[model samples]
Target: MHASREPASRSVVSDVVADCLADIDRIAREYLLEVQKIDDYAGSAVVAQDLEETAVASMELLLRLVGNLPIPDRLAGVSEALGHRRAQQGLPLESLLRAVRMDFRILWTAMLEKVPAEFLPDFTQDAVRVWEAVEFHTIRVHAGYLNELATMAQEKETQRAFLLSRLINSEGKDPQLLGQAARALGVKPESSFIVAVAAGHAQKAFRAGVLRAGVGQFLHERDGALILILEDVPARARREPEGTRAWLAALDCFVAPPARSLAAVPPMLRIALESLPVVTPDRPGQRTVRDAWGYVAATRLGEYGTVLADTVLGPLATISAHERDRLIDTVQAYLRSGSVSETAAELYCHRNTVLNRLARFEQLTSFDPANPQDAATVIAALHVHFLRR
Candidate 1:
């Protein structure tokens, strides 16, 4: 009686396995249709194939496990492979797992239909085994997905850095290579772009703000500054002075005018770098060379502006730095006010003190503040001097 029952049990399991295999094609189709209804699986033929194979392989594994046969190595391999494929296809892991759960539900429902009520207890136990195998397969697939995500993130960062370097330093780089880099960075080679150099410490915050504002931008850190290339950036996207003063209070930003091509970026970046010293802390954001004649002069003169400052302000050099700053401040106030009383009022000093400072400045520089011609030259020299300082 025991031998006869053993054969009968084996036959029942074999018939169950046969029924599962027969439903494999229909189950796969159903799974695909359900997934498609949730989201378009277009351009994902490879992913679909892997998922289908995984479904078929899962059923086979269930058959073998219930039959007391050895599990195939290909089962684990296919599970991991499907996970990696889904990850590469940029499918959300949750969605992938949900689809897997759906496949299991479909297979389990079919298995219930094939087993008789008398054998329902045994069949339910075998179904539990199949569910356990599904869970195990999910673990392997999830591990593979995580690993692929990490690797893909690393590769993307590496590519970003490489492309940024090419864009920042275009010397000897072929036009073709520059175009490729531009495309990778998501900017057209011929598109008008603005290059900005900002304080490196503010890079992450600045980038977050730019992206949040929906501006297309690429950024890289170089020499303690963050260099950014903004593609067709809207006027409103440019950092506003009041906003910068209120929020990114410590940052210094220099923006260049729109450039016609990627090749123009380095020159524009150079102008921004040269204009850095002219940017005052009080005027914290986004200074353009075109906004001020003084900025343009300072950028054009480069280090020569420092030499010019030294030559023009040489007479004041002999004085103590403290007295020098005081005299310079008075000169600035006098130039801005154009009247001794106004200058004194602005400085909260007596009018005699303003007059005396002006006299002393004239004696040191031989450019009298009282005369229009002399005042013009002195004011221009002061701009260059203070800009460099």
Candidate 2:
């Protein structure tokens, strides 16, 4: 069976594989047996007959490729179906690759078995064509597998987002919709949750940050704001809403403190968004109602806030910037400490200096920072000025 040393022609290699076609059944059975050892394939639902058929077809495809014969049109669909089916079965891609690559080993072994030894190395040079065939099937298989995976993920996300919309928009009014969404989204009804909101412009950054931080679940844009619902599972301490807010603050988000039940999200979302106007660099990290109460009240007061700001604090705008800041700083410190001596201590100035600044503030605003009745108006006015800025 010895032959010339000149490299084997394409037709010679094709003949060797074509000869093995009679034994393709045995080669396919061996292919199936080998794949069963792979854990993912062993657990998958792909039937033995189907895999054997794919093995046989793949070998035939290699035969045609090496022979330079036209591949049957249907051969393309066979590989595509193989990849898609394995993907649908949830078999890990490595299993399919391992199984697909076997075509080369089994078919090459068959070809070598039938070729003359003197020409074996020359014939072995054609192994690259066998690999080309393997790669052909591999690329189509990869495409089909990846396409199916993308399709599945997109469909699941679309459905999840839709269900979540119903849950939040209906404000959990529909018990059935709430239950369905909760189940799909892995939210528990009895658990406490935090709903954080950011302006629509911050949606993309906020969402990416939330994902990277792993601090929450379920981000969606609703009613001109982007919101995320974080489940407060006690077992996972990091999921605490307050802790989440501390990190989420870096994302320019306002997070409502944890409240019982997902049903209460709509009202909490309102509270979350209400603080956005007050979230300046000086007043950043304000989340709940208590965090920014004055601003919240000012926002609720509507035009009255404007009127209060103009009547009570507008005169300060005309004063020298340094004097105005000194007076405002003394007044705010006095309000926080409730003692002239403590305000002076907090401001690192003598009692007379504090008194003089307070006097100047009274002359400008006509409200005593120490008087409870006047202090309330002054506080409201400051909130208006802060928010209006």
Candidate 3:
């Protein structure tokens, strides 16, 4: 009796599927009209076509699944195709899923209307099977959409990296090519921009911080360092002081002065590179071209500055190294503080001890910290001395 009833159920299911297929076209049209009213698909012919095709394909899959036919290959192909098309159109996955659910609703409602009352009980169970097929189809679609989006993101990154490399290296000499590269990098060729170079380990965090602060756009990486091109850096600096400092502290960052044009980038980068070695190790965070200018000048002067430093601090050099270091430290503290008491406080020493060191320095160098002219000379000599070291 069970075996006899199996054929009867199969025959009834087949009839229901055939009826559904016969009305598939009408059902698809109604689905399309309803979906067109949705904002995501409104007035979009390509999206309309995609929706119509998806509805037709879904109905066909439902027919085959209900008829108990093996159509996994067809189901997979249609699902992936729908996902790939939607991803290419830059439509959100949620939108695609919403459309898929709508299709299921239309198809299921049509099937219920066409199925005979005698088979409604059986068809209700078959509806579960239909839902399972929809689940499988949706899984494949999601996978395809994610895969396509990944590929697209990778391609865009590759193009962006290439353009950034060309821009940094000044490979595109012509204005037209430079403009194209700048546009690809999402920067204006004529805009004033600053470039910051950061160490490899800190690059990712530094870039994230800059982006998070919304100060400017980070273009790309070059030579194990991250290169950031910032627009209106001075304004951003003023607006986001705390955020700017946070990222700057995370990086061994060197910033160039504003470049007037894309053509000026290479030279500006060179200047920033030249300024790197002159950055004092004690100053680890962001160093601008202006901040490092004194050291840069000392470095450029090289032997001349070294000789001047030696001659100016010659008396101190004659003393024991320890004593010389102490006296020099005292002078630096005094110069920085501009007062013996403040210098003593900073060095964690007695005021008399600081005063004594200052007296000794004045006696050895014949330059008084109290005298502006002599103090200027001592400061210049100290800068050169540090730069030389």
Candidate 3 accuracy as TM-score? 0.72
Each candidate's number of clashing pairs is 0, 0, 0
What are the per-residue Cα lDDT tens digits for candidate 3 across 136-240?
Answer: 677888888998999898888888778767666764367976787777767667655666776444566667777787864454666665677665433223342
Q: Distance from true position, residue 90, model 2, in Å?
A: 1.6
Q: Write the per-residue lDDT of candidate 2 for residues 1-389, one digit (tens) a residue.
A: 12323344655775676787777777777767777888887767888777777778877776676556677888758777877888888888987888788778877777789887776767777778777877887888888899889988788878887887677567566778767877767777666777878744466777788888776456765556777887766333445444355567676667776766767765676677777654545654435566678978987889988999899988998899898877888888898878999998898999999899888888888899888999999988888887787
Compute the lDDT for candidate 2: 0.75
Query: Which one wins on lDDT?
Result: 2
lDDT on C-alpha atoms for all candidate structures: 0.69, 0.75, 0.73
Model 1: per-residue lDDT, tens digit, 1-389?
01123566566766876877777777667666766654635445446566566667766665555555677777747767777878888888887787666656776777778888898776565666567656766787788888889989788867877776766676524788777777677776655566777644456666766556565246666667777777653234544222112222334666766665667766777777766654555566656664445756754676777676676688898999999999989988887769999999999999999999988988888878888898776766776776665
**Order the candidates by TM-score, highest first — what do you get?**
2, 3, 1
Pick the TM-score winner: 2
Assess the local accuracy of residue 192 in candidate 2 as a C-alpha lDDT between 0 and 100: 73
Model 2 stretches astray by more than 4 angstroms: 1-8, 20-26, 45-53, 77-81, 113-122, 183-186, 197-228, 234-251, 282-287, 306-330, 345-349, 352-374
RMSD score of candidate 2 (Å) = 5.0
